[model samples]
Target: MNKPVILCVDDEVMILDCLKRQLKTEFRNTYVYELAENADEAMILIEELEKNKSEILVIISDWLMPGIKGDEFLIGVHQKFPDIIKILLTGQADEKAIRRANTQANMYCHLCKPWSATELIETIKSGLKTISKS
Candidate 1:
């Protein structure tokens, strides 16, 4: 069986690298990690994964991107893949955007930039627990 996937999207390559390293260290072989630079690319990956019968268990996305804001991107993702857990990561997102994401995307959590690795892992763990239950 294909391993469940954790997809992270951020315009900044450095942030994506950091997230990948942290998630890899914590999750190891338990989940597959995928990275995309923007929402458009992420959507392509999501489609491909679905076509391959791979379950995308979670998405961690940055709020500030070139074309699509994180909230909008996540909302679109939720509309199509409602079961995938959505997480927002941002340093500059306004309250309204965050609230909208919570309401529209069923967002699991919002983590700020310069986030603690421990906290990020804990959040993912909590999300994973909820996923397991459902």
Candidate 2:
């Protein structure tokens, strides 16, 4: 079977880099990480992954971004691929975004900014475990 892929979206390069390193260290060769700065690029990557027969297993997106908000981005993904696990990370997520994510996207979880590497890894692992069973 194909190994699962992880799609991460963030406007900041540092967060994306940290996530890549941590996920690589924790999951090792089990995942292929794809990073994008905005929703449009993320969608393009999703299409490419789909063509490669490796749909993304999870998405970790920042709640506050330049263009589309994290909730909006996840909602878009959920519209096409409902099974993909969605996680939102932000320092200042508002109530509107959270409510929208809950009602529309069915967001799996939200992590505060400056999330510990260990916690991030554990969250991803737990999410993957759930995905594995289903």
Candidate 3:
């Protein structure tokens, strides 16, 4: 069976790597980790993953990027796939962006750049609990 995916999008290579590392460390082989450097790539990756019958359970994205911003990207994703949990892990996002994400994208959580791994894992766990109950 194909494993459920956790996708992380960021413009910075290092940030993407770090997020992937942390997620892999925390979740172990529970999820298939995917990384993209921009919103466009992420959107395409999402489509491909879905086409391949892989379940994308979570998406963690950065706010500032080359093309689309995180809020806009997540909102688009939510419109198409409402069940995938969306999270913003950006230091650059302002209050307006965060509010927009919450209202439009149904974002599960927002964490700053220097995120605590424990908090991130806990947040994902809580979000997954709601999904499991439903």
lDDT of 3 by residue, 38-125 (tens): 9999999999999999999999999999989999999999999999999999999999999999999999999997999999899888
Instruction: For each candidate, give its TM-score against the true structure.
Output: 0.98, 0.94, 0.98
Q: Rank by lDDT, descending?
A: 1, 3, 2
What lDDT score goes with residue 91 in model 1?
Answer: 96
- The number of the candidate with the highest lDDT is 1
For model 3, which pairs clash?
Answer: none
> Candidate 3: where is the Cα deviation over 4 Å?
none
Candidate 1 per-residue lDDT over residues 55-93, each given as its tens digit: 999999999999999999999999999999899989999
1-134 in candidate 2: lDDT tens per residue?
Answer: 66779999999899899989988888888788999998888989999899889969999999888888899999999999999989998887898898899889988888898898888878878887888899
Best-to-worst TM-score order: 1, 3, 2
- Which ten-residue region of model 1 has the weakest summed lDDT? 123-132
Per-residue lDDT value at 34 in model 2: 91
Query: How many clashes in each candidate?
Result: 0, 0, 0
Candidate 3 yields a Cα-based lDDT of: 0.95
